[model samples]
Target: MANSAPASVWRNPIHFLAFGLGSGAVPKAPGTFGTLAAVPFFLLLQNLSDVQYAIMLVVTSLVGIYLCGKTSKDLGVHDHSGIVWDEFVGYWITMWMAPAGWFYIVLGFVLFRLFDILKPWPISWIDKNVHGGFGIMLDDILAGLMSFVVLQALVRFVF
Candidate 1:
């Protein structure tokens, strides 16, 4: 992290949105913080129809590529750990197709955060090996997918 702030960051719009208005600029636990930021959004999306939720997730993921990319670039780093809008969208994607209920929502949040933090196998590998905006976004996407599968399977088995 820079001891001094980058002056030009304020002028960059991608940095503005992606950093959560500079929330990502925090020095520690950026991913966790980013995921925390995602929770309210998850609640909102849960109320929408499945198709509406899916469309929103897709659009966010695509825009996240640019948003995350440009913000990382501005920070003079490749996928800096602080930038977490990607994680937000990833969690949304995980929950979008799932049945809507408070219980499932909490479970999904826990599951998504676990996979996100653990980053098992290929997820951890890619996070280490890949670079750029997509790289930052991909691991969380995979983690979200895994969480979604678990949520789906549970719905199938228990419900």
Candidate 2:
């Protein structure tokens, strides 16, 4: 079963981050809301060069492993519903090198959320087989990559 938001999410800095800065604390569809919260951060990152953006992705992803694992362990839950850092990172990944416009942003959002929610093929496999914080983040990472491909393609051809 899915785990609910814990008090530690507000009290502990790590939990606060893992929960996507409290965006995950929402009672329903926290991942969606958490991804919504990520939009502003993505806007901030849009100005970065590709290399710098890649570095930021790496840093955030690495930190997410620790934040998610520690928070899940503390809460005694595996991939708690409120842990939405993965969603934030995933959304960011989807928007990598995307065109600067509301259309691209919204498209990236939809694509990322679709892949994340659907969890096709390897994503579903990894989600089932992996464990701990890395596991929690891996599935979303794949989803982001998949969405990135689609979004980039749209930029190249459709848009």
Candidate 3:
């Protein structure tokens, strides 16, 4: 199926990034596609020192607020399914300093997606009650943080 976004929307760099390099435009499972698009970024940052990695996540999250907010307004949709920059940053957050190799990456991906889609507790509350760019980013941020906690625990205790 064709992308639901307007033609002019792609002209804006913010919208493009917010769409996860067009992966978000996918007709099905855009969030999954966006999360997949994030894998490369996670790999690139894999070797950085913890401080540097943290800085990168902070920068991306800050920028994602504007990106997602603007794109949502432009599309006249709140938290549109195609707006997946949140997924990109969320996946990165979930994978931060995760174990090396494909297994860990896949595990991180699954965990992140699970929390993101499920939107438990604070995530659900934020998704329902918050507004604007920060709101769009907040739920996914919590989901990422939650996934990180679970992944870390599993790595430490189960695996």
Candidate 4:
């Protein structure tokens, strides 16, 4: 798939993020790689105050809409599996306000992946119905929100 991707796919800056800094080009489980690629960024963001983190999240998500949309149009594929920026954003959302520690990171990762893959209820609904850049982002956004709720609960009540 990477080999077949258009040259512009690599040349375009937006594609870099949409492709998860080339992690999305990985042949297997690109979404997982994308999520993993997000870890360092998450660590960086973790140091910020909650307000700063929230602002960055909003910026990333807003840019992601255009980045993913343009890349999908360039690739002639809507929400291509190779486009994993959504995963990066989604995982970050899942980790929002999560407790500090590698344990929480792993927990967030696992839970986010489950919700993303399973696409339960509204997530599934949005995936099937939405279109364009917004469509590309909405499902993962929902998954992240759902995962955030669960992770916060576990952090507060169980751990």
Runs in model 4 lying further than 4 Å from the true structure: 1-7
Candidate 4 lDDT for residue 89: 95
lDDT (10s digit) by residue, model 2, range 20-119: 9999999899999999999999999999999999999999999999999999899888999999999999999999999899998899999999999999
**Candidate 4 least-lDDT 10 residues:** 1-10
RMSD of each: 2.6, 0.8, 1.9, 1.8
Task: Answer with 1 or 3, whichever has the higher lDDT.
Answer: 3
lDDT of each residue in 46-155, candidate 3, tens digit only: 99998898999999999999998998887788898888999988988898878899999999999999999899998999999997789999999999999999899999
Model 1, position 89: C-alpha lDDT score: 79
TM-scores for the candidates: 0.84, 0.98, 0.95, 0.94
Model 2 clash pairs?
A: none
lDDT of each: 0.77, 0.94, 0.88, 0.88
Candidate 2 to truth, TM:
0.98
Task: Return whichever of 1 and 2 wins on TM-score.
Answer: 2
> Best candidate, lDDT-wise?
2
| Candidate 1 weakest lDDT stretch, 10 residues | 1-10
Clashing pairs in 4: none
After TM-score superposition, what is the CA distance of residue 122 in candidate 2 from its true location, in Å?
A: 0.3
